[model samples]
Target chain A: MNPFKTIFGTSAVAAAALVAFGLTAAAPSAQAAEKTSFKLAWSIYVGWMPWGWAADNGIVDKWADKYGIDIEVVQFNDYIESINQYTAGAFDGVTATQMDTLGIPSVGGVDSTALLIGDFSNGNDALILKDGDSVEDVLGRDVHLVELSVSHYLLARALATLGKSERDVTVVNTSDADMIAAYQTDDVTAVVTWNPLVAEILSMPNATKVFDSSDIPGEIIDLTVVNSETLADNPAFGKALAGTWYETMGIMMSDTEAGRAARAAMGKASGTDLAGYDMQIASTKMFFDPAEAAAFGASEDLKTTMESVRTFLFDHGLLGDGAPSADVVGIEFADGTVMGDESNVNLRFTTRYMDMAADGAL
Target chain B: MTRLVNRHPDRPTRLLLAMLPFALLIAAYAIGSDMRLAENPNDKLLPSFTALGDAITRMAFTPDKRTGDYLLWVDTVASLTRIAGGVAIATVFGLLVGVSVGLLPYARATLGGFLSAVAMIPPLAILPILFILFGLGELSKFVLVFAGIGPFIARDIAMRVAELPTEQIVKAQTLGASTWQICTRVVLPQMWPRLMDSVRLSLGAAWLFLIAAEAVASQDGLGYRIFLVRRYLAMDVILPYVAWITLLAFSFDWLLRVLQARLFPWFAPEGASR
Candidate 1:
């Protein structure tokens, strides 16, 4: 017999006995089978810092306690691995991008709902050229990037704007950890990556930003997404996440001393100083105000933006094999409209929770 | 300490003993997998054998739709080629330096401590330097594996040569052997089995450097494929690839043992365990 089986069996029986005793000893609650625990995963990024900040400052616990639940926020070093773990059902929710949320989980047959559109990349993801003036100047140069990531998406978009396809330049698939050192070499002249690496590269002499995600606003969106089934089963999870986000965002974006301290904590969490984090947050078009985020979520602008994102994902074969069309995955907007295959829609943009937060109902 | 010696077990008993731990590990995994899947059928952490089999079939038998290549075979070929190339070069160079520093007093005094220091430096610390100096290509990966294990191999060989009996050198000298003959005919013959042993031990470190280099930057390799699928939580693929790597390494180790035993039978004592 496995050792874990023996231990887990005894403990499981003991826990079940304790739960039965507690239920009989206490009064019945309003709702039956209410889940009071969940796990949320987040990685280091400009927009997603609020999750870590809220967890560290007891804001997550505060919001979770309001709904009589416990929320544990986990941090992942690698961006893609967090999403993978979420898709594997190891996490109840995760901070992901519009592109990754579609390309990975949705394509992998895990239905996820975009509960909150945290922010979009204004100039966060950029294309930098060494000794080059414009994007067109990178015609024959080799481009280094974390392939199949948003940087790759940004590179394709930049190339399209330059009237050149991927064939125009050689792409060197590099890891994010090595991108900085790879660029330090004279051989790597062109690189498409996200900040703060972009900030670090730009600090070098003669480096120019040829293009950035800001050129196409509302395209690169960061979101806090949860499993569709998990959310539908427990509406409190969505409420707790939204409440925690807005509360943290409000404090971090304020002009108060407390806000500065909050921002400093966030900066330190992301391995940067206060000024560096402030600059990154400035580049990131964060939806700090709940009302603005609610309006943005409900607006038709979101639908149009997702249409472009879905098109990009499908065009790049990220929607999985035999997609038939760009509508391989259904995307629900805030206005009760669905794009792609409606019956099989997976990427949902729901504003009910955010709207409630904005209306001060939470 | 009390000497605890036992007679060698019979063939069947020895075989059972060898297979016991592996059998227990497999059984433990099978039970754990069943329990996890029973709780959650969608669990990807501990995939069932069928899932791993399916992943292996997909990677090894089928061609990827996008790339139109058998990824498992391609990765194996690429990884083996790099390991073979790196190990081959390291063996030749390690043997030369080891013999030179072992035989000549001047060479030993000048380079012995230097090579020891080189062996102490962590190879992964200089991975960025390798990439910067050699670019993110096969050359960088090859150089990383070579540099990572070469010093250790040389040091091991030098230690073996230093421990050689002084009587052998005196005998060779009294036989009117030239300095070159004394080094080659007398010393080189004795270092062959030891060199093979050093190479076998260094294979582990060589693989470590190869995987580190490949994981940092590479378009194709077993390490690259493992990391690429890791982003999807494809433990089915990752686990099977890991098993495959273990099998490949084991095969190489067994082959080297066989070669050593066949070519240098005199190195072993009769009725003694390996």
Candidate 2:
């Protein structure tokens, strides 16, 4: 009848059951078994259009079916909140920028892998200034953005280009949706942000594009990140997802009527029409071809990019305590090949699935 | 000398007294800024003076474009209405429960203790459960504030009733008065002043809970506006609304005090005279 005794008795029975069953309770029996169900979270953004396309066209389900699993996609109005939910174990996967993937999951001790590289910002992200003001004019002026985010990184890079340290300018933390309104109030002199906010701000009479992501292309990569344990237990899940993504990309990029129709549907789901969506895509510098992504996966450039990103994140006090080596960002393909720092081992990405897609056996 | 001190000042003396501090401070500031008021008066003093003047102008005159006047008036009315609703509910429940428990010793021991225990639990701790049942709406906010103050008021009234002088009730009974008449005429009137005290205490408690409730989920109230401004880091908007809320709290307290004095003049005649 003692309270402590009752509590311990109940917990002991539960722990015994758990220990008897072992951890991988619901894993599939064979390679061709029915696919597991999953939910993915993402915020509204042009770069994230492909996720909607995959969902509407049955590409995500088809890939899941091929992999023997079911998948559900959920949308959030706030990107950081979506990432937060993912970190809190609310979703199996999340579509977020690379910086968020590192900051939210990698830092929060959730071993996550980048399953797919959606796109990198080209001209979509920018630092806008009033007319007649050069980048030098922005020196010592406050630059507003969502601090500790990709926009902040872009601002730092832009400032570095002008031979000015980040110390030269004050950075104000402002949400993307409110950044335009803040700029309108003249509370701050400059804003570093992404579209459609960037597009809206540029339409203002005195607003001018002082610099954009074009100068530092491929730095702001959008990715589909998944938990490490999920991938480890079900390797085929990764392969199936990548295989379906490549197939969907082929449909989207083809010159066929079906491809155009798919793209238009994708645009609609993303809150933009086809032409507007295309403009966003053009600025995003997306890798439409699977072969190119696979080649990029094999190249040394990704390693260099990740190394620099990790170092920059650490230097800016964005990374958590006890600096993680650059190697933690590395991706090891299923085959013998590896990219990025070897010592920096966190579940970042496994090129194994990309290799399978490249070989046409997925 | 005392009569002279109270005498009305002539125009020159009044002007001199008014202008003395102003002239001295300006002279000191001008000297501190290393500018001669005679020669470079227009340029040197203009910017600093304009900044101060602009601030004063803003405070005295609410801009039509900002819509501050409409917002200020609406927020004031909304907060007052919420407090009134809470107080009205608390008064009815507090009086009924208090009188019942106070009259019965058995009820005092069981129900009075339970109500006091309930009052000890903070309302915020139960907000999520309330939200789940009542939903994220005005009803939830009302329930939260009601729950916060209702039990305290009830228990206080109950305790006050139990401790009331029994001699008066016995005297009324000896005069051949009916139980109902004795209760209504003697007991109720005597409890009024104490009930007002309970109400005054409950109003402050209710306002605290009301602001907390509004801060979480309600859409248009002052707390919600403050939270929205906080999300955008709009310090200007936040500061003005904060000032409005402070003014509102002060005004409501004053209104309650005035209502008490006007309705129950005998409660504090000496205090009012001073």
Which candidate should be chosen as best, given TM-score against the real structure?
1
Model 2, residue A161: C-alpha shift (Å)? 1.5
Docking class of 2: incorrect
What residue pairs are clashing in model 1?
A: A330-A345
lDDT, residue B73, candidate 2: 52
Model 2 — interface RMS deviation? 29.9
Model 2 lDDT tens row, A263-359: 7887787677788777777888777665666566555666666665766766653343334544444445434355454644444655666667777
Write candidate 1's Cα lDDT for A1-362 as tens digits. 43444554566556655543442332211133357788899999989988988898898999999988889999999888898878766677899998889877776656788899899999999999988888899898788887778888888888889778787887767888988888887778899999999999999887899999898887899999998877887899899999999988889889999999988888998899889999998888999887887788888888887777778777755665457999878888878788888888778888888888889989
lDDT (tens digit, per residue) of candidate 2 on B96-157? 88887887667787787788788899988766566566655456667877888888888888
Residue B184, candidate 1: Cα error in Å is: 0.5
Candidate 1 CAPRI level: acceptable
Q: What is the TM-score of chain A in candidate 2?
A: 0.83
The per-candidate TM-score of the B chain, in the order shown, comes to: 0.95, 0.70
**Candidate 2 wrong stretches, greater than 4 Å:** A1-35, A322-344, B1-274
Residue B161 in candidate 2, Cα distance off native in Å: 30
